[model samples]
Target: MLILKIFVFVTSAIYACIAKNIILIVADDLDVVLDGMTPLSSTRKYIGEQGVTFKNAFAAVPICCPNRGSILTGRYQHNHKIFNNSLEGGCYSQTWRAGYEKNTFATILKNRMNYNTFYAGKYLNQISITISWHQY
Candidate 1:
């Protein structure tokens, strides 16, 4: 039993050491086929070359706010309830914060994997409203 416990602890430690790091970059109005990645050489070198690059991901919605909601929550616009860019459409609204924001990928990473998640870009259309890091 002691040997089995030691083996388990060693295996868990090794797995934690080699755990993959995840970085998600979402750019609006940039198409890869139109030389969008040309100016981001450092990003290409560090993140693209060193990590997995997804080649075939499509937005669940055509509009920006709904699409961003889908990306954050890993849900369809119907599920996330952000249909457009206005607060009435659920963009940064109290409804979104109370109901959907807690279920985002950032929350999952921070809560489940113990990842130190960071967000450094535009989120929704009306993100000028006060928002704290812990909100999402």
Candidate 2:
């Protein structure tokens, strides 16, 4: 299919250059030992075999919202200060509006490195309504 071809072309292009693409997939509420995990065999075969794996990697924040923010910004929760999930006091409208949207690693890659970034998944916790989604 055309989508598959496009995917291959884009991925190949990304890997071909010195400025490699950064693809981050964060799945929540999952706990499995990589050695024993079986459902994602295809992913394990492809990305696992051809890509890097971090057996000792960890999340800086246990909360979903904060963790996602940390990943985007490349900063610890303490530094980004997204202390809680989207909520009355600490959600997208309040925190992200403080300038994170423009300064994330996504933005850096897109704006500085001129990479094409794509995010296709769940958004952060409570700030969904106020976000002006950027390509980064």
Choose the strongest candidate by TM-score.
1
Residue range 1-136, candidate 1, lDDT tens digits: 9999999889868877988887677777656888888888987898789976778877799898899889888899889889889999888888889878887887777776656666776888777332324333
lDDT of each: 0.78, 0.68
The Cα error of candidate 1 at residue 128, in Å, is 6.8
Error of 2 at 92 (Å): 2.0
Query: Where does the lowest 10-residue lDDT sum fall in candidate 1?
Result: 127-136
Report the C-alpha displacement of residue 65, candidate 1, in angstroms. 1.0
Clashing pairs in 2: 86-126
TM of each candidate vs. truth: 0.69, 0.65
